[model samples]
Target: MPQARRKTPFSGKAKKQQLQSKKQNKTLLMSTSSGTTSYDVVSVNYQPTRGRGGRDTNRYALKFYRETEEELKIKKEEALKELIPVPEKDLEVNPVDYFPADVSFPKRPPWDFNMTPAQLDAQEQRYFKNYIDSLQASEHWKKMSYFELNLETWRQLWRVLEMCDILLLIVDVRYAGMMFPPSLYSYIQAQKKDMILVLNKIDLVPSSVVAGWKQYLTTAYPALRVLYFTSCPAYNLRGVTSDKAGQSNEDFCETILEKADTSFYTHERYKSGVLSIGCVGQPNVGKSSLLNALMGRCVVSVSKTPGHTKHFQTIYLTPQVRLCDCPGLVFPSTVPRPIQILMGSYPIAQLREPYTTIRYLSERLDMPKLLRIEHPEGDDTWSPRDICDGWAKKKGYLTAKAARLDTYRAANSLLRMALDGRICLWLRPPGFAEHRDKYESCEEIKYIRWVQALTSDQEEQKSDVLTSESDDDRHSDDSDADDDSTDDSETAAIANKFAALAGDD
Candidate 1:
């Protein structure tokens, strides 16, 4: 009942296209009957070869089976798709091995020019040029930001770089990006040293915020590894004691705990060991606190003042590892000095005109609302000075001479509030979610309070703004509907209302 299929020869058009494609390579390049080379023609003053033309003409007429041009092209495209090239795939995107897209160093610092200055200078010029050119060509260059070079202070940092095997770049979680110096990152990388970004004050922000920052940093710097820490551990919190981390820190804010033990596996630098890990960061970023946290006691002096540690020292962690504790330095930044002062990088007291900074802070933070200062003139508007004056009058901060409210004293108090985290102005690393993850599932006693606060802030910010139209609709609904009508399922509304009341109590 079955009929056998008959084989059919390829179409002539396909066969002809195939032969033409192969004519140059698989098919020999035929010559005309004369067999004259180009060299021979050149000797005779441009005599043409007739033999090449005749042989080619005969070869074109010969029949040959070959792959079609379209078929070959399709095969080539398929091959290319399978073999698409990309930058090397990094399997271990972890805290481990990675080749450096290393920031090459300045040939020689001006202070320490030992050899031919001209030679080093020339090399430096060339290296910087190449660095810029390469960056210009790369599509990823848009993601990078520029830095204000503070060459002088980094001298100490440079010395520290030479001495350490692993560099711990400590950053305060509240101001992680501000404290993280791209220049220092370049410098450490230039020295071919291993660096870990240690995010201190972990108890300040939520776990999801921490996770997002970790993810963001890891994305930007593929090799960057992160570890979270807090100087004020759950056990160390003074006066207010809760045998858990999640409840107490948020309840009492992240203030220092008096005379309490705190410990972590993080090491400090200096001394000869199998590995030398150094602690470095902007001042008040908890470099000294980090050391104390690791030691479980106050081995190193800790202060709110920046650069409290003035000298290089060592804290022996173990026989295998040593910590190099270097004094924190105020690195170069293009960010305004007032912002730096607000960031606690520069001393707030060392300023001449603080009015500009006060103005800057007021504009963003709704200072009047925060300070509960109202204008005496009975207007909605108030200048920074006016707000300061109102605050001064409220607090009875009188200038002794004129008996007027002391505006300067009020300003200082505002700055103190910001520094102490009362005002709650903070910078999160980029790509952080607007809606922080509900970390209620995280039952870690030490982390619960922060989670609660983070979630509460997010939820409050997410509430829908009631417009005039929406308010009218709500009123109409109230009049039209039954008084005991269910609002979002009866059980959920009751539970939510009850929870809110309990929280207030």
Candidate 2:
């Protein structure tokens, strides 16, 4: 401070040289302090843009500062635009269009009882590899929905097919044609196994539709026997009384056994006299439910999830008759992915783009009317997105982050309802609408109507009994109340007499 030194302007190059010298001196001091003559020099040149790039934390902070909430929202919208499925032109497509004439499902590779477990596995692997390769070579493979890829699941099906004398192919009545694969029928025919085609969940559709489907399917394949089954038969189709439902289920089992008895028995397993009936179907098509209904108990676990049964399980219906259930397998088909999802072939939780599925269902069915969702824009026009938004609003579904309407959840819930048959989308067989009159007067319809009348009569009688019992209870209650009042008055007079005695004393 006493002697002012000459202040010199430091040039950038000079400053750099000075810093380098200082760093070198520091390194020398460190080497001296360690008392090592030969010390390795470590050079750390932080070229952020070279080799493994560094994170620009400061740049990101600056960018975040520049971006307002509106801008962030716009960016989010732009990102989400990539996930949205492009709308397709709605066309009048036939259900059979999904199954082309040339395409066939993979059959179990020929394995006699002679093959060892290892040999059988090797042969199956070879067959499945060839099947998948061939499918991939064709154009249809790209369009095919997800099928059973696990060898273990297919192995279960093969076991059931090999062991059972009678093959029961259960299909949901809503999409019976799609569910029933011709290749499966062909395989059954080749095996000489008696196959009974069961249109399960008949309660979802009208009786006329059921009869029509039965007629159409039986006519299509003369050897194929078609029977309608419902685990929880609706009151309109069958009486609500458990006794009546149990009787109907028992009769159903009896009819199947009788059919099995009449069928030409040729399998070695058939000689046991214990009828082995194997149930097979695509996933979530009521295979498990049908077995439980037939046994009049939950013999097998039932789930809405596709492929819930992981292995083939055998349950004895009677000492003479047994039912074998195979894990639900998804047979390869050209069915649209959206349609497959709608059919409950795909798991809802694993859905990548559920908006497309919602769109497909909305196009085919009056989803707005079915769900009773009002238009979000207060207009008649309702797109799938609009439908989802409206439903979210009505359901009060919101996101936790910013409390925005949760359209994804809304769409997913709607799909679940449709899959569970709460929102029915029954597909009529070909020529069903034209010959509706014939189907209405069909025997199946008559039988269902008769059952409905019987159920009504039973319900009326039950109500009468309940009313009479309630009336008796009311009378008894009144008599008890009168007795309590009489006892209270007698006690009160006794107390008054005691009080007068005390006053005299």
Candidate 3:
């Protein structure tokens, strides 16, 4: 203590000094008011858009946002505003009602072949910025869900547009109008590229609805060619007894090619050249699945995840016909987030507030009947949350810690079923309901119904065989042999039917 008192300069405590860290001002030498940033620097001779000569870095570069608390609050309010329940009249919705009443998609920016890749990229970026700015300036964008923000993905679309002879604009049958961009159709027309508006996942809707949609689209777009396609077409072949019911994978490819050939040969570029058909659409619309089905093998990976296809891939189906699978590009649209999620445009796992979607789904379908769960409160009243909770209880989806009903898991499971076509909410085209009988009796509808019946019969036969095996296990050996013979005959008959469907003699 005496030594400390003598040595005051070496005391444990020292006076603190106030200091300000220097704030570096980032130079805005390359500032622009166009709302897009350029990666080229005149002084350094480095261009990020051009990238390193051999290595590409722009394709996967996603534009990110830093939202302030105020911006986030505004978004929350907007989202709340969009969660309106489906009206009773909208159960069989007109495709036109869901879209913007008076708005058109932005056209691609003008570019010539003479432009460099860097210049083209920059132009596209600028065009996209203006497009977004225009949308933001208007109140219409709020009606739209999230779209692809990455420039690289759009670049892929641009490449596909320029390279392909025929464009296969795949769309979900449930919401075909929502997926079909008028601007895209116009662009293809201007480019003189033939387009086939493919209505995928036909199994989710009735054949009448499918035929009605096809009729409506063709009538609306007089020059456009529309075709119905489903990777799982087996679901459509169940009931009808037509030669087409036994149509195989080859017939599928041939049907597609026949459509393409009819259009391709009509074009000026159709001279004995390799036909390049570009498969393009919003994500999770079965573009990759269609390609895989056409190829008769898994040439490209497919997932329920939107944008699983990262880049455009070309696969030659025949020596003369090649199909290009473009990565799913979410075109700008006025479709709401809930519809987008329901249409499989958005990933279910990343859904934040799924209750809104549940409400939307509930409004359209009998939730209790669809989910096969009774109301938890022992009454007819069932809210979206109640439905989720009841379903969670029924499915034994519980929280790990509290053992509470996991409504989140239940809601996601319901959404997955909707996406996987287990829970269908069919949206019909305009005037479809008025002439429902006409559509149901159309040749196309009958064919689809036949396919459905055939596939359903096959499924039932398989189930019966499995049940017979399990139930008749204690039976005599003779009974087993008889069962085996019956099964073999049924299997052979099914094979022959499928062979006939495949256009086999």
> Which portions of model 3 miss their true places by more than 4 Å?
1-58, 61-88, 92-107, 233-272, 450-505
RMSD of each: 31.0, 25.0, 14.5
What tens-digit string does per-residue lDDT give for candidate 1 at 1-505? 7788775445565557446434323222223347721211000011122123132212212111122356446543432121122221211122111111332223233333354645653444444445444543444333322221222123345555666788898987666766665656666676666789998765444455566566667777766677766655322322223233222233222223221111112223333445877778866687876676565445566666654454456666666776777666654333444456566665444433455556656655666665555775576666666766776665566777998777776666666555544444555454343324532233442243342333445434422211111111221212342222332232111012112223543
The lDDT ranking, best first, is 3, 2, 1
Query: lDDT tens string, model 2, 1-505?
Result: 5998877555575556446434432332112334643322222111223111322111101000012356446543532231233322232234456766667766677666677776875676677657765775677854766665554466667767777889999888878877877777878888887899988766555666777887787887788997766555222122223333223343444333212111122357565688888889887888866665565444455566665565667677788988877777777787766667778877776554577667667766666655556887797666667878877776666787999888887778777767766556666777786787998787677554332232323323321001111111121222332222222322211011112222333
Q: Report the CA-based lDDT of candidate 3 relative to the real structure.
A: 0.60
| Clashes (candidate 1) | 18
Stretches of candidate 2 exceeding 4 Å from the true structure: 1-96, 112-116, 233-266, 448-505
Q: Encode model 3's per-residue lDDT on 381-450: one tens digit a residue.
A: 6777788887777666678899898888878877877776556676767777688889867778656645
Pick out the ten consecutive residues of candidate 2 with the lowest summed lDDT.
Answer: 57-66
lDDT of each candidate versus the true structure: 0.48, 0.59, 0.60
**Per-prediction tally of clashes:** 18, 0, 21
TM-scores, one per candidate? 0.53, 0.65, 0.69
The C-alpha local distance difference test score for the whole of candidate 2 amounts to 0.59
The TM-score that candidate 3 achieves is: 0.69
lDDT measured at residue 22 in model 2 versus the true structure, 0 to 100: 41
